[model samples]
Target: MPSPNALRRGRRLSSALALGITAIVATTPAATAGSDGRFGWPLQPRPAVLRHFDKPAQNWLPGHRGVDLAGAEGQTVLAAGDGIVVFAGTVADKPVVSIEHPGGLRTTYEPVRAEIPVGRRVGRGTRIGTLESGHPGCATACLHWGARVEGDRRRNREYLDPLGLLRLTPLRLKPVRP
Candidate 1:
């Protein structure tokens, strides 16, 4: 058996290792937008990120599945990547547009007035629609951007952080000193 201090040290080392692995995965080629895999901001100059992705603990649980970008009503919304318009209509009375990209990924923009019809192939940064007035829980007009990975039926569909596709700098873990 190990001493309590030793055990604690071991656990800390394990945690640090796990976090390091996560960072590595996040920065890998499969993780970000690039020549083969990646995405762009729906809003040029990248508007302020009003909200971030907050995945729920369960599939049926309530959580913010996407990011909210600060934008004025009627601001043009662009496609994050090259994809086909799979859906462009009203859902629950809110105008929504969904584009299916490569790798079975689907990006969605809500409260947008659709400018293009379904089956349209849009390139990255292509104008897809305009921001609308109502944004569910948002206090002001904002574009809600969401992405979903499509595959395997065994598990529920997973919602990914849109920021992950931005190819951002790796998160650094700082050391603690006494």
Candidate 2:
């Protein structure tokens, strides 16, 4: 019969193996990048134009948290990918919608003007929101489509630039319309 120490070692090895397998299973899908195995916008909206805009209204200091898309007030906004609308309503002092994707991506549209109830599921490039009218003193109305990773909205730094995730090459900043 195996000694006590020998049996304990066997148990430890078994536990470790189980943990390793679990980790592998969890990451396999993500490691593929996405369902279609591609990261960024799944569709070419507006012909995939690569036009940049003025500096964002907010950023993560060393990094930008969201991508400021130059849009007219009330211009239709689309869901970056297929996901369920986890939140919809005026919160955080502005109208916003949060969508959770299968690949763990989430988006919060700042100052949305469109109507969409919470618990609604949205598809890639589906119109889920619209940009609100810009501030009186401000130049133009733009969409602050921010990405909060993994449905964790509490962390400000947890946000990512929607442009980066969309995989567009950075272009020259366009002047903000008045």
Candidate 3:
């Protein structure tokens, strides 16, 4: 029902749209792949998740900024990814260790006594500190893990669910049906 010229134009538009979608998918980070497991859980044995990361509607709004993993007191807390120790000190009287990874991603672990000092380069799964008890609202000792993208301004920083950084599920290949 359409003219030849209109048919060609529609095909061109569809091709351009497909190309644009492909470009976006190629550039966007794979939430589950984690770049072939570059990142991992901070707590060994994949401790139970007491609480999950809950982002606030606004940066200033109240929300759970990180996930709490049940860990035993004195348990070693490993680095989630390869990065340099940016901060290894107490935050609000609670010991914390923060690492700055590639691509401006920063991960923070609380209730951890830092074994590595600031500016030290650490690989994935490196023991950065030991977990301590007394995390608020947790019945047992837990490690609060948080992640964010470093931005120019404080409000510009975007908080992320730290769990998405790990490639826990194995990749599967599905057959394409003709």
Candidate 4:
């Protein structure tokens, strides 16, 4: 049998290992995504943005971290980019799905019934889930989509504007000299 001191040391070592593994799993996508700049709108044909991302002054303060897009109830929600499903479940009575893109960015859809499972790899435009009925943020049927860069620490996680990642070409004015 191992000595008492040895047992204590073993337990500590095990705890450390567990923590390390958990951290790696949680932050793996960020490292995998790199800076490819390949992302698109989560909603196909790009639904109208009912509301834009308004970052909160502080993490816990009042702010809309994601955009609320106009969508029909039961409409399919697509993955914004290729990545693995990190989370799929309900929170505060609202169903939510989160996908982790290769560049460490995680996109989220809420008021959704997830079709994918955690750890499942998905591609851009993949059907992740369907829109549900109860998003308090929206008066009518809409999908609340949010994005954030994965961080090892809670405070370090940074929320980003999903529009910035989209590949939509901006409308430019034509030169006129009549």
Candidate 5:
């Protein structure tokens, strides 16, 4: 019911928006897998995702900063990439293991009993710890996997979805036809 000129203008705006989004996705390092495509799943057999990542607008805001993958208690948890163990100890009474990968990316796994020690180098899929059952909100045992960009200050750290380290399907764009 609108004029032809208005319709054309709307189409142009929509196209521009799509292109802008594509550009951002294309440039993001985490859009794909790691730089060497050596990243992998932390849990063997590809555990089901109990909860997805929900990043808050601000770092201090309340949000699920990581993902919860369904797994059995005592199940081996592997390293998603080649990295050195930075911390393998308790945090707030919960067992935790953190690894520092290349490119300043750090990965954390909570409710896990650390099998490796700090400063140990781990390759992709190396056993880092065993998943524990105390993670709240999960019906069964789950692994809370998290990733962040290591920064000098805590406020400068950028949290990322640990699943992004996996080499999933590539994003393919196709032309839309009228």
Candidate 6:
């Protein structure tokens, strides 16, 4: 039988572990997307091809962490916004791409072999690399992307929903003058 103090300690430790895991998962990118409030960024993944337009539920603890896109293998990966490639290499058994914008939002693309070199600034629609999400730990074959706003804690996440930033408003032609 466990003592009362021991039980209390165990509960506290479990709580801490759960919180830590939540923080990590919330911040990390996923093959599926939600909101994109992290980097003062534009709406995510350019919701043009993929048909799913469902927004994630509001957590209230933090805004959306990153954007996600379901893609085919070896599809051309494009830049989310204008920024310099800060990280483009393999980590945790998957290819990764990281970009930092002048606005202070740090964006990352995971499960991809970035074609662009680190420190090179890329504009919107610039091809960065190919999708490498089929590897182990990246089962869904999708893009996991996230962003970090300036002056925010490293672990706090506190990101904006990428969906709002990445949404594509239909373009309307101006009225023809008589």
Among the numbered candidates, top lDDT falls to 3
lDDT of 1 by residue, 1-178 (tens): 8999999999999999976665554444484334344578898767889899999988679999999998889899999988899999999999999998765667899989999999999999899999997897778899999987654462646687777667455679999999
Tens-digit lDDT track for model 6 on 1-178?
A: 9999999999999999976665555444531132342223222344332222233454344333455566667777777777788999988777899877654456777678878899898887688898765643334566666655543355433455445445434789999999
- Provide TM-scores for the models: 0.73, 0.58, 0.77, 0.75, 0.76, 0.55
Q: Candidate 6 overall Cα lDDT vs. reference?
A: 0.61
lDDT of each: 0.83, 0.59, 0.87, 0.81, 0.86, 0.61
lDDT of 5 by residue, 70-177 (tens): 999999999988889999999999999999876567889989999999999999999998999989998899999998875545656778877777767777999999
Task: Candidate 3: give the clashing pairs.
Answer: none
* Rank by lDDT (best first): 3, 5, 1, 4, 6, 2
Candidate 3 residue spans exceeding 4 A from truth: 1-28, 31-35, 170-178
Residue pairs clashing, model 2: none
Model 3 vs. true fold: TM? 0.77
The regions of model 5 sitting more than 4 angstroms off are: 1-35, 170-178
- Comparison by TM-score, 5 against 6, better one: 5
Question: What tens digits encode model 4's per-residue C-alpha lDDT throughout 1-178?
Answer: 9999999999999999987765575455434333345676777667999999999987788899988899888888898888899999988888999988754578889988999899999998899989887677678899888888766666678787677667566799999999
Model 3 Cα shift for residue 88 (angstroms) = 0.6
lDDT per residue as tens, model 3, 52-125? 99999998999999999999999999999999999999889999999998666789999999999999999999
Better of 1 and 2 by TM-score: 1
For candidate 2, the lDDT comes to 0.59
lDDT by residue for model 2 over 50-101, one digit each (tens)? 2333344454344445555555676777777777888888775777778876
> Between 4 and 5, whose TM-score is larger?
5
Clashes of 2: 0
Candidate 5, residue 15: how far the Cα is off, in Å: 43
Runs of candidate 6 exceeding 4 Å displacement: 1-64, 135-140, 152-157, 170-178
